[model samples]
Target: MVHETAAPASELVLEPFELSDDFYQRPHDAYDLLRARGAAHFVRFPDGGTGWLVTDYEAAKAVFLDPAVSKALKSPGAQAALGGDAGGAAMFGDMMLFYDPPEHTRLRALVNRAFSGRAVRELAPRITELADGLLAGLAEDAATEQDLLDRYAFPLPMLVICELLGVPNEDRDSFRAWSTTLVSNDETPEARGAAVSQFLGYIDGLIRAKQEAPADDLLSELISASEDGDRLSHRELISMVFLLLIAGFETTVNLISNAVAILLTDNGVRAALAADPGRMADFVEEALRFESPAGEGTFRYTTAPVTVGGIEIPAGQRVLVSMAAADRDPSRFDDPHRVDLDRADKNHLAFGYGVHRCVGAPLARMEGGVALTRLLAAYPDLVLATDTELSWRKSLIVRGLTALPVRLRP
Candidate 1:
């Protein structure tokens, strides 16, 4: 039988565990603690359940690719252990990430066209234009202190995804709000539930619209996909769109914001990138390794008893792979904590590994490369607006900045 409990934050005693304040706020410190401990360790959740937190790099890659640990539809217990609530169950039940192969493989194949290499290249011109437009607006207001995240980082990704998915321009505001609440752990359960409901309702209408009058958007393509006459069900299509919106936009937002935060704080790194725009890709890669947006890997539940990093995790136990910790593992990276844009063989688990690797990774890389490159090119003297206190989202699953205030030099 599965066990659950709620103990004092201090009693958890895991080096990688978050302090109460940090748990609800910034989690980099917690991940650092975990890295200090070792590869894998036991963690006590807020609900009192004991779960394995994998901090080692190679071990995390192993778990991510292990078919023995299934993401099948029946793993509701595993979902809950990953901090998912009832609404998450409803919306994520049919997503590609929640299923093990051959179902996972089949679904991923059908949608791969959207993110395929050729498709991403086709979208490049559009992405560049969008980035330029956003920067134009920022430039006008660059005279005073600005929240780079609010003015640029946040809207850029949302607009790009909305354009890609064919979400009506006017409806993006509501969609953005709904998507934010659904991924937020700070909100009450009821609030999240309501957000999910609203999101589903909106998506349902969009799917119907696509059915009646299909467009060339990703949603239309997903709505019409057929594999040997097998296609996504209505519910599956809705869930897929929901997943794309959250995964595509949220991750990029954090990545751009996090890269900016890191660049501003580290003058040496910032100067190197500013000096050589060609080196932006390396800078982005190191940023991803140094501080990943997804704080931890998606939750995985063991379908059969398995030993990971010498720890015996029994069947049905929830396992969390700390992407932040794994990326910083000393075994895989020398001087892992330091930001080295020139670091070679920088194969960090930032996009995860194996079957459940982020589908939108290519797109995210393209977006980050373009955004950072342009931001540096446009605002050569950008600096933090103030030495303001930075706040993180409450959700452990995602590491993101709540607000990033900065000033663009004239």
Candidate 2:
């Protein structure tokens, strides 16, 4: 598919990928057109910068695995696009996501033990218990129209991540607001800065508490890593905690909510899963492939001139994979748009590719499977209470519903 450098960056005429109406309403339609044009499209960003948007699976995988593509926020334009200041870009600092190989390797190694297979297995019972408690509350509520996102999807993951990080239940309301503000695109610069400041303050305070008296929690474990000679810096500690809270909670919230949204809308798939509980994992996989919580992978800067899908992207330009688009690329999967839970190959780039793949994916899958399975068992006739199309959160990266209204019973 390599077609040679599509002119030089300076000479190339940037076409307006005008997706105002279709972007929110039906993004995949827009993606289809973009993919047809080429593997990479020179589109305008929210910040008014033009960058390459890779929707082809092969090109995206290459971009992800290419060492020439950097994960740092060193570029001023990229920093602006990510809503970050000059000093610190998004997830900047000694965090794994912002670092390249050696640093990312070191940082990822420090916490890899915490999210190991053993750790996730141990967390299963607690997650199930939490889901049960949430379902009980939902059943008790007299309101016929219940918001699954608020009641079950949002809180379940939020509480689980908070508990893992040792964040108190009382502070969850504030945490929720901060996390939402941090992820959303609706906020102004001043608002985003304020939210970032408050979020940092809260995380710093929590970290200090964990450092003062370590407990039997993930935060305590992370804090104690310094004591064991791993030596996480203050910035790194805060960033790690911030990442876990946001990544662990926000992403899972969308996954759960999106899966339910699909089930309520697609009766055939719903009935198949309801009849066979064993297929819940497959259902979750298909959902992830279809409606990825993360629409685009994090920003990657081209360190050297690179050709993606045969188009040469000049160095110093920002680039990213459209996971939502790539997952549905016709070349990669047969009938990519269709929801098939029984597909033989369920492997998709929902979590991402290479080292930067979402670290919380294991926890997400476990929780998603448990949540869908038990929710269906508890309320067999669960259906959407509203006839309107579900509204989505206004975000450039995260794809999820603002709310999902459903009735637990007929």
Candidate 3:
């Protein structure tokens, strides 16, 4: 039987989170208010779900380590709180993000083999080549001052992930639209469901094709495992592929875009990276902390009563760890707002912590480093286009710029 709990009297309630408008422009300001109030603030999320938002670094880490916390989708009150037909679970529920040990452990182990460091290392050269190819197109559009997100940042990761999953490049545009809608806070649940259905159907077809004629790709390897050991069901296979493909490049798109914006705006960082191009990795780390690409970690619900930052949260309630806010916790990071490439402690929760940490982190880091290094080398005088206005993506989970117009030459 499913167990649940009632809310305690000490629960701190606040207004619904403002993900659009002001919050999109300056999310830190809102995060600052929440952090100042306490380590954790109970807020009605944009989806109308009331949950605890952990803002401080220590608190965030504690929540990650707490055994009482769970990734199970059957949270007692979460569905009603989120209103009818919550679409997030349909997309992310069957994946690793919403599973616990034994199930999570089994799935992680199988996928981990394909994402091993050696595999990522082998792909680095191809990623660098891909970046150069994308840069060539950007150079062609130099005179027009194109949007960086559209011209390079968005397509590069999308292409790489498509190639990695052995999916046809021709279908890129369709999945790109699907990805945008899935993570978008602006889309309605019904709309999001349509996108999910289409994406899963496509993936289902891809998996079946791989099963019949195995190839030298990750999908083939997974299909092999499924056929050999009956280790995976159809839903698990589709969900795993979905998680990898979406989580694989979506965050990297934002990371690379954020790096370009940061490097151009801050000459000091640009000069530092220019002097020692090897520090491109460090630059990516700082960007992860300073302006986290993934604004927040996936949701976790408490199986038992737990206290975070002295606020008592009862069992069965949802919890959200703000990775963006935690990375900038003044207590953990010095000059938290500043982007410093030389900082000794580059530890950031951008990829998350513990068991639920991103499986594609190594690929993300390599992609960011290669993209930054090549982008800077290709366009020595790259700077944001003053004529165009910059806009941030209106998303609570993923934080990034919608458009970053830039000139190729100084």
Strongest candidate by TM-score: 2
Q: In model 1, where do residues sit more than 4 Å from their true spots? A: 1-19, 24-26, 46-50, 76-88, 117-119
- Candidate 3: list runs displaced more than 4 Å: 1-20, 46-48, 75-92, 117-119, 226-230, 387-389
Model 2 alpha-carbon drift over 4 Å, by segment: 1-13, 46-49, 75-87, 117-120, 226-228
Backbone clash tally (model 2): 2
C-alpha lDDT score of every prediction, in listed order: 0.78, 0.81, 0.80
Please state every model's RMSD to the true fold in angstroms.
4.1, 3.7, 4.7
Superposition error at 159 for model 3 (Å): 1.0
Which lDDT tens digits does candidate 3 get at residues 17-79? 434356667778878777876898776555545678899999999999887888766444344
Best by lDDT: 2
What TM-score fits each model? Answer: 0.90, 0.92, 0.91
The order by descending TM-score is 2, 3, 1
Clash pairs detected, candidate 3: none
Question: Taking the tens digit of each residue's C-alpha lDDT, what string does model 1 give over 1-410?
Answer: 11223566665434224234445464555556665655666776443445777888888888887776776645755644454443255567788878888888888877785555343457778888998888988876787888898888988898888988889778878877886786676677798878888888888898899899978778887877776777888988888898898898888999999999999999999888768888888988898988898887466778777778776676666788888888888888999889998899678888888888888998899899899888888888988877667777766667788889888874
Pairs in clash, predicted candidate 2: 2-310, 3-310
Question: Looking at model 1, which ten-residue stretch has the lowest summed lDDT?
Answer: 12-21
Q: Candidate 3 has what TM-score?
A: 0.91
